[model samples]
Target: MRPAHVIAAAGAVIASLSLLSACGKDDAAGGKSGAIAVTATDSSCEVGAKSGAAGATTFKVTNKGSQVNELEILAPDGKIVSERENIGPGTGAEITVSLSAGTYKVLCSAGMTGRGPSQTFTVTGKGKATDPRLDAAVASYRIYIGEQVDDTLAKTKKFAASVKKGDMAGAKAEFAPSRFGWEAIEPVAESFGDIDPKVDTREADLEKNQKWTGWHQIEKALWKTGSLKGEGPYADDLVNEIGILKQRVGTASITATSMANGAKELLDEVATGKITGEEDTFSHTDLSDFKANVDGAQKAFELLKPVVQERDAALTSDLTDEFAKVQKLLTKYEKGDGYVSYDTVGKSQRKELSDEVNALAEPLSKLAGVVAK
Candidate 1:
């Protein structure tokens, strides 16, 4: 199964959705700093600096492989520290982070599947970063997530009603919009532990007897099997599950670390899944997922922009421009409220989408560290 650019809660890659810019070096404190270059080929991961004095360090990653590559910084326990995704062949992205001395892993997913490569990256510093103003920003973003969750639940009800009523055309129309809220706030959703799996887990992640449920399950019935005879009960379960999530997310404890990383993770979802046409295999609504991920990430970025601007105006400007570029590209795919199905796109055009999305991911990957600082 495809892994993350659009997904990261614990390991590998899972994402929901890019940009490029010349970001300036650290202006805060430059104690021991250097660029650890990460290069990815079709079959392997290449890392330049494996060890560093770690108050703050930079990883300059370039993808030399054919597929879109996402470079991840992982804690020894496997939680993602930071990542940059949608990095297409011949393109690059970078991130600078302040860290406590510890062992870490540099991960790259080349084929967007089975672990592409991993290497030890040891940080040898005891220094710490001063906490930025994250409380209010994170709170605001949580509120945003809650709002999106509510919308997801509401729209899902509409979708389920259509499905239960056997209005396949109407139900199909509602499917993409119903997922927007969940995709935007998935990392947060995944934070709920079991609830996420229950609501969105696909056959790929479950054991044969795990009793798969949620949107993807319903997705398969509609698109893959083209059968709705026994789908009404499943549709009802989805609505109920989202309703449960809506209640829980309202009071969830969301942190800047998660929200910032959540933005990157959502993009990872798009890079690894939607872009590859491996997600939504039935309806081909991958473009719809792609847009939601971007929208979700953009909201997070917008909320945190004030803090980032104060830190570095140039980097913020570059990110702003990159978002616009990606948005313009998405506009080309827009048809009414949704986009044309992923299968409708041609090979050359798919490459174009890949490039633009990758361009967005490069700059998009830096969000976590900038705001977390």
Candidate 2:
């Protein structure tokens, strides 16, 4: 099935479960005298509402199609009043929401679209007091984090194994996918506010050596056909560099695993409604956890740093500076809105950051053999 379809199916289930567990008071002054019925058809959603006293009403949704789907009720303010997920094709479920007298939209989009068709309803009377489903929504996020982390670990291991076999092409293919997995789960990591400061410091280095910004200027010399004299050694140097990076694969795996486990616990708290997304936003608190993990990683790097320095202080300095830049970028997010606006930050900055980080890796990767000689 398409990814959208799978997401829709999963959402339907969560929504259905939450609806079943919901309980509310029925005040005669602000209760719907009848039920509201909604239907989803080929890219369209239809909602039926009966004239009533108004206030709080319950919507019982029945999926009359063969595809799984979900329902979302949006308030004027864009807050979700009630959302039902994982409704099996042909199964029926109900969602109760407290709404005041006004217009509201009922949206139905299968998990795949990330959005669905919407139908409006009118409630004429005083609005009823209702609560948001913050708890249930966070529970869903917990599940998402676990799945992403598992995928990341598997991909990273495969990438390392490919490097071990000297299959640079294979390793490259695995890189982006693995990187994406970690990036998606980063928000969960940020919740801890425990990331290492050293990692934060690497930002400047990454900025200076980015592939496009600075490296692009030297790409011709770096990868020319017959290894040009001075640069030839650099290419040959890299041929054996993967082996050195492969040695650290075990460390990377451990770090990824540890972060996944910690993220799960944090997500659990979110699922139980004990914490709000705002509470963990930008992972200010979780930075502490990340810092501890970075500390261990720093220890591992320390062993290699000496060898790296001996082989090429320029490379070591490049990497150290790159890490510092990353630290600074992360620290910026630590304050204010806790959002890392990669777009607003500009591509130039991003390119610079990537160059520096890659440059650091370039030299360190050659250090093993360099030190041995």
Candidate 3:
């Protein structure tokens, strides 16, 4: 999903700290000294330097545009390696990514329309050696992603079968459950840059004249119309696209920093879409997506907990407490199998949930800094 401008205030502090810390580093090794400056404007994305050493490199992004812009680093194959989204006009944000030796592209999407100016960025030298604990975090997260893809594909197939048979009740019963796996590993799925829009685009995100084909299309049919009529082709497309997502999983490049950033991004997903009940509009299944996002974010945090504990014990404690609080709050709304419809949730209740998410999001935003250290 294309998210709204939702950078938490707490993240700005960390971005400054990261910039300060990088200033003291030795850049003697080819663009490794300090945070690289990336200036994003209405029509251009300009990099301060053309190359950097292969390691955890921070881009100090300043939005010089009049609209909200996003900074993205794309790999040679065009997969998004890391991105900082929803950067408002005249505001700045930072994204730290661990890069390997390769040629990459740095893009700034003006207004978050997925189009903007780009500059070629090259990483030189073998990447700096990383801590074993960080390496372990990446390995464990990769395993988790693979498992999620496997389970999501399986559930999606069952949902598709029900749709193919024109069994509206069964498909509705399976819809939210089928989406849990996808929501859990969404960051990984979204990195592909191609498959995510095909499978997960919401009605609001559709461009002019673009065909609507995805889970939401089927969902609208199931809940709003109470029929699966003429929906079989879209169902088949979903399954096939999900199958492609499974195949593309192995090709994704991730790092310990990427995992941390992705965790924060998951919370952003919750704040912008799931919390607003915009994700599953027709089905009112936003809480399921919300819980899955939290699940995925917490899993990433848990995998990196040892490293985080070793680096900043207080941050770890804060994260743990906040995650528990949010989970406990979510539990109150649970029905027998799934959550109560989001539309039934009162404004005050929604505010409570939003508050918990914002609280959790604060400490979680610092995760990339901790892991990168």
Please tell me which predicted candidate would have the highest TM-score against the true structure: 3
Model 2 per-residue lDDT tens digits across residues 1-373: 1123333423422332232222222211123534566666537777775343455466666666666666766655544444555455556555555556667788886542326788777778764332233223234444544565566556555654554555545543443343333334442332222221111111122233433221111122222322233433323333223233233222221122122222222222222111111111221233322322233233333434554566578766765675465456446534342334233445465344434333333333332233222
lDDT of 1 at 257: 52
Which of 1 and 3 is ahead in TM-score? 3
RMSD of each: 7.1, 23.3, 4.4
Candidate no. 2 TM-score? 0.31
Q: What is the clash count for each candidate, in the order shown?
A: 25, 64, 1
lDDT, each prediction: 0.71, 0.40, 0.83
Q: Global CA lDDT of candidate 3, please? A: 0.83
Segments of candidate 2 deviating more than 4 angstroms: 1-4, 7-33, 50-53, 127-373
lDDT of 3 by residue, 1-373 (tens): 3733323322332233222222222322224537788878989998888998988888877777787677888998888888877676666777788899999999999867667899999999997689998898889889999999999999999999999999988998899999999899888898887788888988878887989898999999998888888999999999999999888898898989899988988887787677777789999999999999999999999999998999999999999999999999999989989999999999899878888887888788788987887
TM-score of each: 0.69, 0.31, 0.91
Encode model 1's per-residue lDDT on 236-348: one tens digit a residue: 89988888887777655445555666676777677667777767877899898888888888888888888889876876887788778878888998899889988999988
Q: Which model, 2 or 3, shows the larger lDDT?
A: 3
